[model samples]
Target: MKLSGLKSVENAHDDSIWACAWVPATENRPALLLTGSLDESVRLWRADGLEPFLPSPSTGHCLGVVSVAAHPSGAVAASASLDSFVRVFDVDSNATIGTLEAPPSEVWGMQFDPKGAMLAVAGGSSGAVKLWDTSTFELLATLPVTPPNQQDQQPPPRPASKGSTPGGKFALSVAWSADGRRLACGSMDGTIAVFDVARGKLLHQLDGHFMPVRSLVYSPMDSRVLFSASDDAHVHIYDAEGKSLVGAMAGHASWVLSVDASPDGGAVATGSSDRTVKLWDIKMRAAVQTMGTHGDPVWGVAFRPPGGAGVRAGRLASVSDDRSISLYDYS
Candidate 1:
């Protein structure tokens, strides 16, 4: 699939547009694109022309929004800010549904369970992942990261310096398997850890990136394949079950901030600090097209979810540091 730039809405947001998501179609209206910005607001837009649908302002976020997620049913969405707060709100009514917070760390990225029963937040600098029960908005569990085995038999002695440790795990991004049986989170130190959700045990770690992994997603069609975008300016495809890196796709001139796989798993879209959005053919492991639609860093880009009420073809939305949002027609 390829993308043809459809429309660009300048100043769609007041500050940097940091996150983007799509609310599935409902009987009353087609699917809508939801975006969160450094301006501390979450705005909704019509999918066709990127027109304003609901420009509701979300206050209370002390810092830039880092992530946004939609419930499978399209009734609710959650947004997380750099201040470590997760706000859940009704998608259609824009009513505040729930709020969650954690201490001594920041919340960077998040995703709802496939069944929409729970929410997962990447616990920044906390060396853990936090899960919340959606219905009650209560903190469920904190999954600690396991240290990887060092190649040397005797690893360097733990640093004697204050606040210095052999391994500093800072979770930055997260993803859920297609069946929701597994959860994977990437960290600032370039490691992807997998966990068996039912058992709540650390499974294994996938290694490849030498820099922070900022975004990750599973192929909607295959539960075992995972795609990750990192500050290393490369996308790593992993064999999730085998804990091996199968391929690496590189092209972005700067940090790749976001990535999403197409519903069909035929392609992947990425937004980069290079001020460009790219579409890559996964089979070829190369960027098929690049659209320089944003004047500043592109923070988020997402392919609209499939199987919404009136949506037959695919759509892509991108948000940027320029306080603008762009829409593209995917075919």
Candidate 2:
């Protein structure tokens, strides 16, 4: 499938469009595109023309929105902001369902369980993945990250000349396995920590990128493969279960802010601070098409989830620093 730019809404947001997701269709409406911006608003757009459907702006997020995720059931979606608040809201009614918070820690990326039973938030600077029971909005667990391969004994402290500190860990992005049995989170230091959700134990770390990983997503069809986008301007495909870097796709001239795989698992779309949206052929491990459709840095790009009511053609949505949102036809 190729992408043809359909529409661009300039100044759709006030500041930066940081995150976007597709809200699967309900019985009365087609699938809609949900976008969150640094302006602290979460918006819903009609899928057909990318027009604003519900102007009931979700407010009260004190900081920039960092990530947005829609539950598989089409009833709820969650958003995480720099203020470290995870707001779970109803999709159709535009009502706040729940608000989750963890003190002394900022929030970044987030995802809902495949079965919509839980919400996972990447706890920034907290070195943990926070899970909430969806029904009760109760704190389920905090999965702490373990340092990779350090000897049992603690290492010596660094010299005064060095600026870095010891024992500081920051988590930035998170993904859940399709079966909801496994969870993986990426950190500011470029480490992907895997965990067994059932046991709440650390599994292993997937290492490749040396820069902050901004986004992570698991292929719905193959839970073993994970895609990561980093500030290094490359998308790395990792064997999540095998803990090996399958390959890296690079082309963006600046930080790759967001990366998402097509539901069919054949293509991936990435938004970059370089002011462009790119479509990558996963099998070729290269960018096959580039669309400079946004006037400013593109921060978020998302593929519409499949199997929703009345959903047919593939759809892609992108939000930018230019305060605009762009829609593309992927067919």
Candidate 3:
């Protein structure tokens, strides 16, 4: 498989685009590309031509929008900002569905449950993953990423303490398993905490890189497998349940910022501080192709969810600090 540049938009955002997700298609519309930027706005684009879905950028966030997540049903989505608030809104109308806040904590990355029942946010400094009920938008639970001994302890009280928790696991990015039974969150110290979602407990910790792990994702076709990108400049694949490092792909010259598994489960794509995007073949554990289309560090890369009528071919999208968005044909 290879990636061919199809379309790229210069100045897609006024500032850095930090997050991207493919919103699945509803009965009335095809899937759309959702992006959040340091410009403090969230934008949606047509998957085919990169046309703006909204007349103007959707605004409400402050301190720049850092993360965006689409519900499985495609009717609603969520965006989080550095200001510590998550705005859940209707996809079509941009109507505010709900606003979520966990006092004294910052939001970094977010993902909706596979069944669209819950939304998980990586709670920075709170050292936990916060889950909210999607239906009622109520706070469901907080899964702390502390060590086994401190697992039962609550995160530092409302006004968070200055020092780090015993584990020092400041949650940065989060991903849910395909079966929805497991969840994983990456931390600043490069530790990955896997949790049993149903019990809201940390299952085990995976360690490899020494720097921050900024992004992670469970294989779309395998619940036991997980991939993580880190400031150490390597992408590590893990057998989450086994608590073992299966393999680590090293190629990026700088920090690997983001990673996503292809829908077919055969390959994974990564964006890096090296100003390049790479496609790594899982079976070979090596990069098959690299695209240096962005002039600045690439921040996010995502594969379009497989479903929508007449959309059989694969597509990948990447956003960067250069304020551009690029789409590629993945086949």
How many clashing residue pairs appear in each of the predictions shown? 0, 0, 0
The models' CA-based lDDT, in order, is 0.84, 0.82, 0.89
- Model 1: how far residue 187 lies from native, Å: 0.4
Which 10 consecutive residues of model 2 have the lowest summed lDDT? 157-166
Q: What tens-digit string does per-residue lDDT give for candidate 3 at 21-72?
A: 9999998899999999989999999997999999988888877888899999
Candidate 1 per-residue lDDT over residues 44-85, each given as its tens digit = 888888888875566658877778899988888888876668
RMSD of 2: 3.9
Query: Higher-lDDT candidate among 1 and 2?
Result: 1
Candidate 1: regions farther than 4 A off: 148-167
How many residue-pair clashes does candidate 3 contain?
0
Best by TM-score: 3
The candidate that wins on lDDT is: 3
The candidate 1 region of ten consecutive residues with least summed lDDT is 156-165
